[model samples]
Target: MLKIEDLHVAVDGAEILKGLTLEVPAGEVHAIMGPNGSGKSTLSHTIAGRDAYEVLSGGVTLDGDNLLALDPNERAAKGLFLSFQHPIEIPGVQTMNFIRTAMNAQRKARSEEEISAADFLKSIRAKAKLVGLNDAKIKRPFNVGFSGGEKKRMEMLQLVMFEPRFAIMDETDSGLDIDALKMVGDVVNELRDPSRGFLVITHYQRLLDYIKPDAVHVLADGRIVKSGGPELAAELERSGYDQFIEAA
Candidate 1:
């Protein structure tokens, strides 16, 4: 559902992603593993249309539509969801209000009806519990005073609530305990459908154990250098990224 071709991105005039090309078809999960400075986050941010991540060349598209031409909110309305590696806190924003507003905004953008308050409350509560978040936690301000794992759980809550067509999970497993990892996996697995796709960006293979990927790709020096079956993640865990770093 997501296609990126020869994507060269620069941050502050320094090139990071050099000729990176990858694709995650509908109904498949693709995991990208690479060491630090391999442009993993850059690729994610660029695809999400984050500011300052300048796309020097190449193209990114969602289901054949040019994504680079659209703003980030537009992409979200198109059913593209990005689970941030570092989910930020908006101190003044009420968690429920923020999420409901976003959900309705996307729906409105797509010419759909807004979710009623009663329905949204019921859905969010169920999804929050599924993601290991309590009612008190969701009642708090957007991620205010939440632990890292809790924040990740909050991300999953949004994921299941939004039910996006394509998801880019950027290190959702970072700082997560085993239970949190399993929760992340459960949410993704539950949301998986023939019409949905996932691009999982992670530095370690532990998360892969919980969420079985259809393909594993090795990213080095801002480009995807190698790709294989799930065994590729196992191999990387055994061998480390030294070989890929040197090869790049």
Candidate 2:
């Protein structure tokens, strides 16, 4: 399980996540929705152990491990993955080489053997097809010359290839069309299992229509004010965040 107990975080000496607490158990997907500046990104970054976000108080744990104590790479090696809101472009690095290096680094951290080139190529090819990326795209530099939607697809590609125990997808649907949205849902659904969990952060209810979450939480002013089932997403879509914004 991934648990956050009264998580208090600050960025640039200003508090963003205030007394935020939540839990996502294994085998379920949870969605977080909020207006601008509600600390949605902060929560994800804090859990992922980003250095700029300072944890003033409270705790975050995966299963039983103290996540806050680990560095970002340590957290990743522990099966924590965060799909960034803006995927970066690495100009000089080869896509396959970067991924393989990262995969091996994580494995090495866990005392596991590295993947062979043949096996890695086979796996990447299969997952690339699943994420709707052709061989040519995979061969290109990471996120170089790709559109916004394609960048999101690249994120999904890593999500599937890594198969982390818990994933935080931060606004992955921002620039995707219906087809890309469905492809995102397809990859997520295929990876959903009893031992894994997801925290999907999105603005629109359309993505929820594709991958229905077990629970949805409303975040406002750095705290979760209300939580409900999948129906809450539709309600939010209709009512909007005006009421919640005032409440915050």
Candidate 3:
């Protein structure tokens, strides 16, 4: 389980996540819907151990392990993954090499043997196709010259390749079209399992049409003010965030 109890995080001198508390159990996908500046991204960043998103007080745990105590890479080694809201481009890095190195590093940290080159190539090729990336695209440097939708696909490619225990997808649907959205959903659904969990953050309910979260939470002013089943997303889409904004 991924648990956050009264997490308080500040970016710069201003607090963004104000006493936010949330829990995502294993084997379920939870969607967080909120307005702009509601701290949705902050919660994801803080959980992923991003720098400058200072945790003033509170606790975060992944299956009883204290997450706040671990460094970002250490957290990744612990089966935590965050798909960035805006994936960046690394000009000098080879996409395939970077991902393989990361996977091997995680395996090494867990006292497991490194994956063979043959196995990695096979897996990456399969996952790449699933995410709609061609061989030439994967052969390119990470995200360099790729379109916005392609970058999101690259993120999905990483998500599937890593197959982390917990995944926090921060606004992955932001720039994706219908086909891309379905592709994202396909990758996630393929990776979904009893031991894995997902926290999907988004502003629109359209993405839910594909991923179909197990539960939906309303995040306002850095706190989860309300929660419900998948229907909650539809409600937010119909009534909009005005009510939740006032309640927050």
How many residue pairs collide in each prediction? Answer: 0, 0, 0
Candidate 2 per-residue lDDT over residues 145-195, each given as its tens digit: 999999999999999888899999999999899999999999889999999
Error of 3 at 226 (Å): 0.6
- TM for candidate 2 is 0.99
lDDT of 2 at 162: 88
Model 1, 74-167: lDDT tens digits are 9999999999999999998889999999999999999999999999999999989999899998888999999999999989999999999999
Error at 4, model 1, angstroms = 0.6
Q: List the residue pairs that clash in candidate 2.
A: none
TM-score of each: 0.99, 0.99, 0.98
Error of 2 at 5 (Å): 0.5
After superposing all C-alphas onto the true structure, candidate 2 shows an RMSD in angstroms of 0.6
Q: Between prediction 2 and prediction 3, which has the larger lDDT?
A: 2
Residue range with the least summed lDDT across 10 consecutive positions in model 1: 131-140
Runs in model 1 lying further than 4 Å from the true structure: none
